[model samples]
Each structure stands twice: as structure tokens, then as C-alpha cells.
Target: MSAIEASPAQQATVRMAARALGRAGLVHAYGHCSLRLNHDYLLVCAPMPPGLIQREAGVVVPIRGELPDGVLGEVRIHQQIYARRNDVGAVARSMPPSVMSLSTAGITPVPRHGPGTYFAPSAPLWDDVQLVRSTPQAEGVAETLGHARAVVMRGNGAVVVGATLEEAVAFTWFLEDAARVECAIRAMRLENASAMSAEDAARRATTAGRVIERMWDYLSAGDLELNSSHA
Candidate 1:
């Protein structure tokens, strides 16, 4: 059991990520997010109804095990990712409609905006459409993901990883935006939907760290607004 308990601040970040991603339509009742507590254990959003996730809702789940009550079965996804990537501190499994739609097709999102540049060089598309349930399946996903910030699961959605919960959560939205823009452009049948040049993308990539931080702040505020609206 590699999973361990999360600190109070880490738990708060996990909850915020869930609500922010849900409010942004990047995830729903079916999807989930997680934060690595260390090299072993992870804190994941326990299975629950849709909407905002509060601090108390995060579950400390092991990398491999009989899951605790409320923990999603797909936890292996996070476990395998963390096991494979020493640099990853957070992971998100979101199913945004646009990202899902684009995943099933041959289209790949390029740097179309500042947010899109977070993926910089490019994003990988995982051809498998099957759910990541078992350890082997999750391991497969990690392989496909490689060093990419995110990977589109064919006929599924996407898996995003980052060095922080904030970055990972921001990536969920940024990746969705990229997919949405690509889909919109495809719909228009643009003759020249030019992607950002490598030089420009490289320049933008240099600012990705700060960009994700700001995006996290902005999205967390949006999550608060959604909370207030529901109040």
C-alpha cells in the first residue's frame, strides 16, 4: 500500500480542484482527481454526488488495495501514474465533452491560446478506449502518457499530471479549452487553422509555471462563485 494520508493543506487543494473542475464542466459525478501525498500514498476525491467538494471529502487511498468506502475504483490510475512518474505530485481524470469528442477522432489540439501553450510541444492521444481499472491498464496509460502533461484517452476523456495540485487542476481546464477551440475550428472547416510556431510555443512554455499558478487562482475563485450561487 503506497498510499498515505494527506496534510490539511493538501486536502484543501484536492477539494478545491474537484469543485473547480466540476464547475468548469471538465469533470462530473463520474470523474475524479487526486494529489500525491508522497512517493507512496495519494489523496483522492471520494465518490459522491456532483457539485462542490468540501475539505472533509477527500479519502486517503493506497496505490493498490481493497478501496475504502467512497473511494473510486479507478484509483489505480493515480497510483500507476505516481508510481511511474517521480515528478508527478497530482493527477486528474476529467471527462470534458469537447476533449472526449476530440479523443475519438483523429484531431489533435495544438497551441491555440496562452492556456493551450501549457501543453507546449504537443499532447499525446492514448488510442485505448477502455476504462483504466486494473493495475496493468493503468500502467499502460502511464506508458502512453510518457512525459506529456496530459493524454487524451480515445473514446474516454483525459488524464492530466503536474507537479502541484494547482497546476494539475489548471491543466484540466486548459486542456479542455484547447480541445474546445480545436473542435470549434474544425466545425468551421477553416482552410488554415495554423498552430503556434515552435519558437512561439517554446517562449510560451517558459511561462507555463506562472500561468498555471494564476489559472489556479482564477479557477478557484470561479469555484467559490459557484459555491455561492448554490448557497
Candidate 2:
């Protein structure tokens, strides 16, 4: 009952993403994560909470088609993009507290903080967390992310995509970090807005990418047993 007919390596990446996001506190038990097996196909997690969703069984759904289970509405956004572009591989939807809270309050993450944060001068389709109402709405959203890392949903949360699960999870981590930094900076009302400039954010995106590769290694090794850590 697994979704999609993917290689063991691809499936392992899916499980790794679930565990890493749970550990990073992005998942709850209801949120969803998916990887594009190909432009017309993907592997979706079962319906459940963000942190607790399981892959033991899922509805292998295909684009240009429909499933009896009905897809998550939020997934419409990702599906729309995959239907149009072949560049994106993994997509995740989660309501991380900081990003959620910040979006509601109209706060912005300053990835300009350093080379570990993922924000930018050319990030795309996002300014103060623009929230699109439907899947087709994401078409405009993708236009903005033409080459940036991720995009935020105004007052909702975020949808992060990358070439691999590891890349996607890493973006999610820094997205949170950027949020954390913004929260702290605002609480203190510090005058270092320049701390979040564009140049620094791109640099950090690069560094964060490397850090995530190391994590991908640890995750792929099978020594961590991440599933039990959550149980």
C-alpha cells in the first residue's frame, strides 16, 4: 500500500525526511510530505498529523489523474507546480509555530543574518508571506521562485521544495531559524536590519546546503533509528 513505485533509495529518503522534520519540530502528526518520483508521479504520506504521519501505507497518486482518497487541498499547490515544471522533486507542507505565528503577525525572517540562513534578494513570489488561495494560485507563486530556495505563505505557513528530501528539510530548518531570529530581533527592537541583507542570505543558503548533506549522510546510515526517537 505504498504510494508510487520508487527505488528503495528514494523510499529511504522519504522516511528520512519524515524523521528529520519530526525532530526539527516541523511535523505534528497531520502535516504532509511528498517526493516527486517523476513529473507525473509522487509518493505521499498517509493522512495523519504532521509529525506522526506514517508511510507504511499510502495512496499512490498520479498527476493528470485523481484518487478515491482525495488529495489534501494544500497539496494542490505542489501538484500544480509538478504538472508544469520538472525541476522540483520534493515538497513539504507544514505549519511550524514560529513561521505560523510570524506570518499571522506580519513578521519577516531575516535570512540575511548570516551564511546559514535561507533568504534572499531574489527569493521569489514572496513579500510579507503572500498566501495564495488555490493550487492554480501557486502558478504565480512559482513564477517568483524561478531560482530562489523557498517561498512563504502569508498568514498560513510555508511550502518548501528541493531536489531531494534532504534539501527540502534543510530549507525548512533555516526558514525556522530565520523566523526565530526575526522574533528575537523584534523583541529586542535592535537596529540591525542590515543584519538580514541579501548577500549574506545566499551565502548562508550555500552553507546550510552543506550542513544538510552531512545530515543526509547520518540519516542514510541507519544508525540513528529516528523512528523510535519519536515514539
lDDT of 1 by residue, 1-231 (tens): 333556666666777788878777888777888887766578887676334566455788776555666566677778888888989999989888888888788455889876678786667887887787777887788888998899888888889999987888888888888888988988999868888988887777654357776887787784543343223
Q: How large is the C-alpha RMSD of every model relative to the true structure? A: 3.8, 4.5
TM-score of each: 0.87, 0.78
lDDT to native, each model: 0.77, 0.62
Please report the TM-score between candidate 2 and the true structure. 0.78
lDDT tens string, model 2, 1-231? 335576655555566677667767876754667788776788766666644544554445675555335566556666665676577788777667777777775555655465235566523324544445464566666664565566666666677777776777777776777777777777788775656455555555564346777755553444344443234
Tell me how candidate 1 scores on lDDT: 0.77
Backbone clash total, candidate 2 = 19
- TM-score of model number 1: 0.87
Q: How accurate locally is residue 5 in candidate 2, as Cα lDDT from 0 to 100?
A: 76
Off by over 4 Å in 1: 1-4, 49-52, 64-70, 222-231
lDDT of candidate 2? 0.62
